[model samples]
Target chain A: MTDTTQAAPASTRDRLLDTAAELFYRDGIGVGVEVLCRAAGVSKRSMYQLFGSKDEVVAASLERRLPASEAFLLPPADDDRPPRARILHVFERLEVMTAEADFRGCPFVAAAVEVKSPEHPASLVARRAKNALTAFFQGEAERGGARDAALLARQLTVVFDGCGARAVVQAQPLDGLAVVTAAALLDGAGMRS
Target chain B: MTDTTQAAPASTRDRLLDTAAELFYRDGIGVGVEVLCRAAGVSKRSMYQLFGSKDEVVAASLERRLPASEAFLLPPADDDRPPRARILHVFERLEVMTAEADFRGCPFVAAAVEVKSPEHPASLVARRAKNALTAFFQGEAERGGARDAALLARQLTVVFDGCGARAVVQAQPLDGLAVVTAAALLDGAGMRS
Candidate 1:
């Protein structure tokens, strides 16, 4: 429980964002601003003051989540695990993520589909989430000494995103399957399997 | 354009299904029934009489599409191509599918995400679509003489779906990469690559 007195504007804003993120990720973006205000205990006036619009709230929520998602997909900093293993470790985190009761698929993929306009704020946030994963994969692939880091990164990201979709659509844990497939992918690419 | 005056009930019904499927697939299910009715040039009364609800319309659209989707993924009957090749042929079709300007990844995948409720009518439709793909893969795997046809089918499906998600998120083709990974998956499983 946060101290109400110490709760600043940032705290109020975070409460709103946290609620919005949960609703948006758990359910689709079909959720509305009125419902969002009700869920967050914030008035509509303050909601708009803080976040501008529902789209901004959506984008902000995704932006807030980007680092956490990146971290979960990232193995660790200063850890000497081989690059291929680090790359595969993303699935390990994925398994843990999908194991949660509230597990939903990739929020970015959902947002990308829901916010149809390519230049929409939420769309850009979703794109950032996706590109972050790709860049992470590229860093690890380069560390693992892949001859073509970009190609490897793109392929791994596909398997990663695919696993997310399968997990949600099938409503089951597919990270193990993804991990196995990723290994085969590494081996096929002449990386350490 | 459909001829409204001469349209029989069956033709009117098909017009709704055809237009709804086109709209639902091209855009997300965000397109409402009013828009669907408008596009199909049908009355809401007739639409309700034929399909029941928007959910039903979405489900029916997907159901109406099953045979055609199956046809594209299915290897040619009496296809003289190697079983492994038949198995990999799905990606070949996938490339063509994604190449369409209006392609929005897998409709079933989109439906699975967009429909929200797993027990929803459209949800079930999406599941059926996925299962059909799996069944197709299993058949090809068996025909290819795989030691474990089901295993190859599952693995290949992962890569197949991964490619689909990747293609949409990146707005680029990863079917080529998926084809390569599918080959490796087959090879690793002791199936012919």
Candidate 2:
């Protein structure tokens, strides 16, 4: 095998991306580019040369968070459960997340609140992420046989948003209460027994 | 009555409070004190004399928001209803708030997330505000005749948190959707028909 210890050119990009994600996710994109460059052990010129602008770097950082959110929202394939069960799994994941040390709430929601301009690319991505999750809930509600899937989806989306806020703001794990409550609603809707 | 146009000696204090609230609420507290002083038509020395530091000014500005929140959370005496109805009324008020032209997400939540330190007095106030809300839901759930009142209260709290985030982040109005959804949950818990 080649000596992997040598500094790699691509490693710089990775370092920059990782540092940007942490700072943006923790503080917000309003943090200056110079701070990010220093934290990443790169010069401003090199950072600009690689990422073009601060916005692009923030976009890249936000893109890193999507996969984790996707995993949180989706159910495990081996579970083999009804749509309601699958939907509830998302909350279970969130509960676990809230229990993690240094949990500061949903990064996407936090970022969405901080990024002022709706037209900003980072804001657009955050919005799309929320929309995608809402759409997924809508699909799940429909499959679960709600009379008004759209309404149910919207409601579930509200619960999801509330759970994240409670988890962070209250500094308490949401305790899977949102899922249990949502499941009860679905069952009452005649979607489940 | 005294001349209405005659400004009181303490009017400067009120002006600083008003300007800080407007700026801090519209933009985050990061906006410089000079800007706030200019907007309020007060001198920097006067601002310093009135509020010693920026943090003190920010705390005072946030304190001003508390009354509005209290009004929203606790409505007029003639508005008396059952616990479930009262809970729904809170969301109804929030719907109006979300539709306002300058609506932002919860100032407390925004401030809490930015401050990072849980020990900060402002952060403590933010936490207390959230806890107060949760306690309100719990009290309502218990009064509504739910067997598992605490569980139901926590669930409803999540719904409130979610609605607030969605209103600001997704630009969605918290209307009949949250009300209907939450009412359905309370109904399922046998709190309502």
Candidate 3:
């Protein structure tokens, strides 16, 4: 057995962001800054030195989440599925996420709801996440030859957002209800059911 | 004359709940009890005397919302309208709520997301709100003669929940996106298009 196989622990700043992500997403931003610092095993001075303010930390936590979220909506690189089929696949991914023990609905939505200012840095990030998803839907709808790309995009976005909301509010795990609804909506749009 | 004609002020307990409902819905439940008491103009001791705890205040706040929320989903008591049109009318009610200057997303959904515990009194209210909506959908689906009323209830719930989430998160006032989707879904289920 190797005696010195361990890698270095996460850096102080990384540790703080990781902890902040979990706390803010799990418990909302009402958690006091002091409580967060202590939970992260970080000194207040170090946290300030690294992130400037608690609001910035909230923004940074969501920023760190961007990559995984983008991946969730992005169709697989290797699959050659039709655009509409690929779009519907996002729900399957949502089901897997909802089934996780840590499923807390959409962090961006939670962040936006907790903040008062639309101008808040975190609110901007949250808004951007949703807007980007609508763009994804529009692009997919266009690829699928929809009669009205914008309409399809908004409908898809509503259903996707609804699934997250219903999942968390009802405190039920994912159930593919949104997927079924989306398929029916697509059929009515003249796409193959 | 004005002084003598003035009605008695609201009870301190009612004041506290009124304030709590406004604050908890406008902001998340992350608002401190001190802030709530200040806004309510009730001393902390008096607030505790009435509601016993902040969590109970939150629970009571959602409970206060029940009648209004139910009215939004309920069909007209004496009207003989078709089931699907009646169901889609809920979105029209939602649009009115969304247009209110003080409108936030569903209060129960907001409450559920902020608190960590599913067992939290507020979370129970949220789950109950969602369950009640699902039942409304199932009843409507059955009346509409859908082959699978339960499935329609769940799918409709998903779309309805999505609309609220999308509204608050995107900071857009409610539009008819959910209604249009619901109409198409109903048509697919054998309701007239």
Q: Which has the greatest DockQ?
A: 3
lDDT tens digits by residue: candidate 3, A34-105? 999899999899888877788999999898888888897668778688877888887777777777777788
A75-130 in candidate 2: lDDT tens per residue? 86576787888778787787788787777777777776666545567777777888
Q: How many Å off is the CA of B70 in candidate 2?
A: 2.2
Better of 1 and 2 by TM-score: 1
The full ranking of all candidates by DockQ, starting with the best, is 3, 2, 1
Q: Report how far off residue A60 is in candidate 1 (Å).
A: 1.7
Local error of candidate 2 at residue B41 (angstroms): 3.4
Candidate 3, superposed: residue stretches over 4 Å from native: A1-11, B1-10
Candidate 1 per-residue lDDT over residues A1-193, each given as its tens digit: 4666667778889999999999988777878888988999988998989876888999999899988888777877976888888887897888777777666678887777766555679878877788888898888777777767787777777777777777767877774777877777777667882
How does model 1 score by TM-score? 0.89
DockQ of each model vs. true complex: 0.55, 0.56, 0.60
The candidate, 1 or 2, that scores higher on lDDT is 1
Fraction of native contacts, model 3: 0.71
CA-RMSD of model 2? 3.7
If both were scored by DockQ, which would come out higher, candidate 1 or candidate 2?
Answer: 2
- Residue B148, candidate 2: Cα error in Å is 2.9
